[model samples]
Target: MLKERVINETVPIQKIYDEEIMKAHFSSETLPSVPLVYKIQPGSNQARKNLTPTLPSSSSFDIPDAYQSTNSDETFLIYDKLVSCKKRVLIFASPK
Candidate 1:
């Protein structure tokens, strides 16, 4: 298993998704499109930040795990499940 850490500055969700979609639109294997909606929230001014590992040259293997986001601004650690086989995932969405 491998690990990656990322911290993205705060930004609107739509902006982030748009940027990603535009970049992936030209890709050969891209996921289907999804509807877009924007709802301002308390932290709408904050940017989205995530940490993912840098894929190596060898594409034969998968990341082999999942992740969880933190509610507060803190460093979140991720571990491989190959050893424990536990699915520990978390997602921190903005308040509605």
Candidate 2:
């Protein structure tokens, strides 16, 4: 059934220089002065793996406390709704 919605998609590919200039901090010397090339690809899984290291620091591991509601019944209700939707959500990356 899901096969009917399997449409093709195009994604851009980029190769950043100074990828390893420094892993801890960014300095003026390490920053790029101008925009770099933006290559397009038919599709590739490598981009998904390569992107983990490039995300901003704020999104790496921070979690909000509000999402952890104390009421068990409310949590179960939310879980039931999510299951009933029957949607396959492929979250490639999430904010930390």
Per-prediction backbone clash count: 8, 2
Report the C-alpha lDDT of model 1 over 1-96, residue by residue, as the tens digit.
001111243344555656655665654444543444344322333322224456556433444223333446343444323333343343334333
Q: Best-fitting candidate, measured by lDDT?
A: 1
| lDDT value, residue 68 of candidate 1 | 39
TM-score of 2: 0.17
Model 1, poorest ten-residue lDDT window?
Answer: 1-10
* Candidate-wise lDDT, in order: 0.39, 0.31
- The Cα RMSD in angstroms, rounded to one decimal, for candidate 1 relative to the true structure is 15.4
Q: Write the per-residue lDDT of candidate 2 for residues 1-96, one digit (tens) a residue.
A: 111111211222332222322343566865664333332222233544443344435323323333323323233113211223343222222222
Give the CA lDDT, 0 to 100, for residue 31 in model 2.
64
TM-score for each model: 0.24, 0.17
- Every model's Cα RMSD, please? 15.4, 16.0
